[model samples]
Structure formats: structure tokens, C-alpha cells
Target: MPGSITGTIVDPTGATVAGARVRISHRDQSAEQEALSGDDGQYSLPNVTPGPFQLTITLVGFTTQASSGILRSGENYTVPQIAMPLATAVTEVRVVPSRVEVAEDQIKAQEKQRVLGVVPNFYVSYDHHAVPLAPKQKFELAWKTTVDPVSFGVTGAIAGIQQAQNDFSGYGQGAQGYGKRFGASYANFLASTYIGGAILPSLLKQDPRYFYKGAGSKRSRVLYAIANSVICKGDNGHWQANYSSILGSLAAGGISNLYYPAKNRDGAELTFENTLIGISESAAVNLLQEFFIRKLTRNIPNYEPVSP
Candidate 1:
């Protein structure tokens, strides 16, 4: 059972083709052949030893073409040009977005984590590339902290402590005295935070948050925490002189003179002294944040794991 077999291949448009795989087979025995079509879509398997056979042609990105035929000894079988159909499309698409939009959404979610369910903890950003907040966002955070119920509770507690200690004696011992002290303390809180955390930070391009640098050696982390009292991250993410914290400290101290008992008022020298004290206090608090507060904070999200 031997004969010759031949075939050609074409595209759906029925034009001459090349670079196609042509295969032939019979039961239990087979001969494989391949040829590129001439420009006229002509091909042949001349003198091909044959029996009943199958032919398949294929090309990239096109449906394969196939046919069946029979051949007897010394016969030439020519298959019509096999036309291939187009393959289905494989579509791929991708999407990307601006970084600022992602950061803004993060900020919105962080605005909700209040300590004791009341004190605003809006300043921290877990994201390393947290876009520098706009001036509006700074003030908005300040406003949120000021209006929180815990702020009033803390103010009342401070006023009570001052009354018990009789610290502002000029405010006298009574409801009116307590009122004066409360107002003064509340005013102090407002001025310091708005000036340091919002207004001046916006003007000076300083970030007021204690950036948690939870990595590196303990000594380096300690130094970074302390240095932050006098240095701050700028919108550009570089360390810069912390004019906002310094000036806000001084401004808060200066404003205190206006509301305290006249005898308790600090002169300019005392104001500068108090400002230094405030800076020291900030360093201590930053160190605490670096080491302790994260443990105490109940609802903060995205906290990095601290090694034991």
C-alpha cells in the first residue's frame, strides 16, 4: 500500500502560504513531511510512500487546517489548498493610578481611629510615601482633635487639678476661678496645636508627627527619636530644621503670659526657657512613641511588628 501524496495551504483569503507544518499518517505506520508553499500556494509530497492518510497544517495565530485521504501504490493524490481561519484574539489590559489619590484615601481612613474612642490620632501615616498633607488637611486634623470629646474631658481634668493645687491663686477659689483656669488651659492647648501642628507646619513645610522608625539598632533609633524634637520631615521627605515645632513652642509659651495670673506670667526670658522645656518634652514623648505608645494604643491600624 504505497503511493504519492501532495497538498498546499492558504490563509482564509486563499492566498499562497509558507511556513506551515504538514503531517501524514496511516494505521501503525507513518511518514511525516513538511514543505513551504510556493508563491502560488502550491505544494507536493512527490513520491511519498503512502496508504490511507491524514494531513494537518498549522501556523501561528491561525486555526489549524486538516483533511483525510487514501492513496494506492504509485498514485499521486493532490489535496486542495487548505485554508486556515483566524485565531481568536487574546486581549490584555492594565490600569494604574496617581499616588496622591491612594494616599488621600489612606488619610481618610486614619481620621477615624480615636484614642479611648475620643482623642484624635490623625497625624500618623503608616505608608512610607504618605503624601505630605495639604494645608487644609493639617487644619482639618487640628480641628478634629480640638472638637473631640476627650479634649474637653482632659481640659476639665486639668482645670480640676489646677484648682485643687491652687496653682493659679489669682483666679480665686470658686466656680469663676475654675472657669478662668479651664479657659486658660484650653486656650493653651488650642494655640500650641494649631500653631505647631497646623499653621506653622504648613508655612514651614514641616511634618509634626513622630515618624515611627521601628528599624535599625536601638541606639540609632534612640538618636533619631531625640533628633526629631529639633528636626522634622518635610513634604519632600527629607530631614529639615523643625522651625514649626520650635516657633510653635515659643509662641505657645508667649501666649500663656496673656491668660495666666499676672504674678504667674513669664517674661520673654521665661518664655524662651519654657520653649526649651517644651522641646525637651517633645523629645521625651517621641521616644515614648518609638518605644511604648504603640503597645498602649488600642485601635491603630497597619502597625509594624516589633521584635521582642
Candidate 2:
């Protein structure tokens, strides 16, 4: 004959735990009986096969409980009240920014950088492992550079100097001449900046920033800086020939022939000459960036120096 089992469930605080599942099983028998604790925390398993049996109680948010006892045939067995403890709490957190987000933050930092708090120095990155900019970011940087108030002031100053020296004499003299010179100079600046820094970089998947190599011997640093003009880091983070800058210079120079005086336009000869001049200027500026510019640049991030 089968037996019966009864039990009550509670929490660690001795409060009755309703809805707790109670399972009774005998090792010697294939049958198992189950019940759920009522509102009063009481449970009863009827028709349980009598033998060595185990009772298990389980509920959400509480630890499972088990009890074992011996039962005789046709006997009514009552299990001791089960007290369940609260389950331990576990939580996990992750705070990683996406690559585009990281790059945007870095760009924000770079935009604040200026030489002596005056001239823009947005093209230099102190972090060697800086994230590559997306196409939109490249254009954003170029736009920021070209539209800055300082850029206009600098271009106007250059035009004034050219006028004083009677350079680009085709523009003639007076306010009209100065206006034309100013327009031409600003156009050149805009063309070179966008073509070299944004457009070609976006298409070619290259980095337009100068990566500062602050460590190593003076000669090695000089070589690194000079070599950077002809070669640059690709978006893949590998060193590659700087076709973007080289071709951009040529393209910008070619475009200049349209606005400059007819006599000054040397066609392909002028384009190649301007390209060479641009490269030379880049090399010189890179040398300055390596040796002296960082000290003068304000709002620089406290980035760790990268090894050559």
C-alpha cells in the first residue's frame, strides 16, 4: 500500500513561503509524487510509495531545499518544515565605447589644440594608436579647419604680404587687387585642406593626421618626421605611401590654374612644381611638429608618448 507525505515551506525569517514546489521520490520505487505549498505554506503528497524517500522544495528567488526520510507501507509521513534562504544576487556591467564614438571624442580633443592658443593644430595626433576617422569625420575636420576664424585671418595676412611684395601681379593694385589676392589665397587653402585632408583620405582609406613620435634619438625623430611626408599610416594602421597627399597637391595645383593669371599658369609644369613645393613644405612642417610644435601647442591631451 502507498503512504502519504506532508510538509510546510518557509523562508529564513520563518515567514510561510506559498507556491513552493514539493517533490517526493523513493529510491526503491519508480514512482514520484509532487505537490505545491498552499497559501498557508502547507503541502501534502498522497499515495507515495513507502521506502527511503527524498523531498525537494524549490521556489524562485530562494535556495532549493532537500530532506530525506524512511517511510513504512500504509504510514503517513510528515516532513519537517523547509526553510529556504534568499538567492545571492549577481550583476554584470560593461562600459566600452564604439570605434566611431572614440574617434569623435579624440577629434573633439584635437580641435581644441592650437599653437600658442592661436593657430589651429588640428591635424596632429599625440596618440599613436588613435582610432581612424570615418569619411564623415574626415570631412568634418576639413570643414572645421577651413571655416575657422583664424584660417581667414591667416589667409588675409598672406594676401596682404603678397600684395606688399607685388607677387601675383596679375591681380593688379588697389582694393580690387587685394580682394582678388585674398580670394585666391583662401581658395588655395580651402582646396589643399579639403582635397588632402578629407576627400582623398576618405576615398583612399588613409589617415590625414601627423602621428607624433616623441621618443628616440634626435636623428631618428628627424628621419621619422621627414619620412612621414612621403608615407603615412593607412586606416588599417599600417605604413603606406602617401598617395592621397601627393595626388591631392597635384590636383589642387592644377585647379589653381583656372583662377590665377594666364602668364603664371604653366600647365603641367606649374602643377608638378607646386606639388614638389607642397611636399617640401610638409616635410619642414613635420620637422617643426616633431621638435618644437608640441611645446607650443595648447590644449593638448596628456597622452603617453609613443615610441618610434
- TM-scores for all candidates: the values are 0.65, 0.70
lDDT of 2 by residue, 179-231 (tens): 99999999999899999999999999999999998887999999999999999
Whole-model lDDT values for every prediction:
0.74, 0.87
Estimate the overall C-alpha local distance difference test score of candidate 2: 0.87
| lDDT (Cα, 0-100) at 226 in candidate 1 | 92
**Cα distance off (Å), candidate 1, residue 109:** 3.1
| Candidate 1 positional error at 37, Å | 34
Clashes of 1: 0
Clashing pairs in 2: none
